[model samples]
Target: MSKADNMLSILWMLRSGKKMTAQQLADELEIHVRTVYRCIDSLCASGVPIIADSGPNGGFQILGTFADSPLMFDAEEQKALVHASVFAQEAGYPHTDALGRAVDKLKRYTNEKQLTQIERHSSGLSVLQPPIDPEQKGRLQCLEEAAGQRQTLRMVYGGSKGDPGTGSVREFDPYSIIHWKGQWYTTGYCHLRKDLRNFRVDRIVSLDVTDRRFERPENFSAKDVLLEQLLPDPAGDPSLVTVRIQAHDHVLNELKQHWLLGHALIERSPGEAVYRLDSTSLHSYVPYFLLPYGKALTIAEPESLVLRMAEVSRGIAEHYGSMLSGLPSE
Candidate 1:
């Protein structure tokens, strides 16, 4: 194996539950015992926290609670980590801190040659530029503290319409802070309004933590509440709508692995398969699934979604026409 690959293998072995002696590693790598010692020293120097014990039963081991944890990565997880690291750096805050720490850990298990390769690959990656608002950062920090401590806060929040003249100052019992679609929102119980409300963190003009403590509802979960609010109801009906759609084999395989689709009924015919899903907002996701398949898949569903797709097609045609005429697409 290459030097870099050898180092990774050695780290993986050390991280495994089985303790390996220098002689064992040398035999496995087809190298001298001294070379194995040198490699171990290099790993330690790079902050791998490897421990060597001196006894008949003793051997080299990675000294950590996570030593036996699996290091194997499927292709997607590796790509995701690399991409997320780039994004964290560009975000210029907590993500940057996390990315730096992750890179440090990755470097410990890598040799100089592998480090060089990773640096070259990572240099080409970039993160999206985040909006610059120092005040928003401060408010986010305050919100984080309030959420962690379960404290009440008095703040002047700007209205959604962006009229500062109509902004209201009120007290709120912060339950949680959620990031949704690039915007930050703080969901809490408003003392002034006497109701549960979601406030945009960026709209917070002034904030002060209160000494009065509040209790979170025993049955209230942030994720449950968020999903309940997000999933749209068709018209005024709250009934779950089931829709069937044909999907490519690759897409079908991927969807099968998803726990959310466990309740879905699937049928196979010819080169494709159909999935029947019961969701309140089936119309929103049906187009998403169809986009990747193009004309390969058909939506065999509630007639409303079919009409929606037709309208979307008409809109796209109009957009293309306006683009060709050198007019605004909107």
Candidate 2:
């Protein structure tokens, strides 16, 4: 057996209602006595319930209370757990090593038939996700730990993806870390801004967990905070305007899934969607969002929005026209 399997086997041996010495465990598993001692220590470090009694009659055993407890997952439940682990990893879950160990333990305890079935299910399934950036991955792990342990973090925030590691430094108390779309975000209290804010983990140039501690607000919900930011209550902002659009039926499915327009949708029909958005965004983000649809989408109301789209089209044409002029005769 591999070292990991050896360790799991030792766990099983200890649960037989009989005290066992390290030498006996090593002999039974056909490994070294020292290996058994190391496995015991590793199990303890992993938070397994183990007791070491030191005396002539002393031996190591799992805590009596937990000794009889078995891994309760049946075949289908086991397959589901394996599949879920794959989904979690693909979503860039931090603490992947711990997750791997947990899954290994689950597989180690299952019988032969169940193990074969699990392998078959796992092989037939696959998941696709955006590639994880190493810097973002490290920051995500730190943010998650800081949130759980209530530790404040000092980080340099802001910068374009092409040129990171150059930004303003600030202290933040991470309340939550979440994965949305293909990006990672840490929502928290920013000491610099003196308000709650969310920062994309990828945009964080550098990060360090601080010794400072903080008490999270009572009944805090980071998800709710993020949702409100993405889809604000339009009534609260009197400057907002309603914009309506019509798209071909062939493209409506994808248009309905648009991040900003989809969330702001007030009403919809076969080829039309009405959305309420601040004029600033309507002039900026909305134009870029609908430009790709071209003729498939048509702006119907708010003449300013229609004019802005025309302006965007004109700018694109002028810029490309200049670039083509500079390129030597084709």
Per-prediction TM-score, please? Answer: 0.48, 0.76
Q: Alpha carbon lDDT of residue 31, candidate 2?
A: 96
Candidate 1 structure quality by residue, lDDT tens digits, 80-143: 5666677644553433455676666665454344446666667778756777377777777787
In candidate 1, what residue range of length 10 has the lowest lDDT sum?
Answer: 229-238
The whole-model C-alpha lDDT of candidate 1 against the native structure comes to 0.68
The best candidate in terms of lDDT: 2
Kindly report which residue stretches of model 1 are placed more than 4 angstroms away from their true locations once superposed: 1-133, 155-162, 165-170, 179-185, 192-212, 217-220, 231-238, 252-289, 325-330
Give the CA lDDT, 0 to 100, for residue 259 in model 1: 40
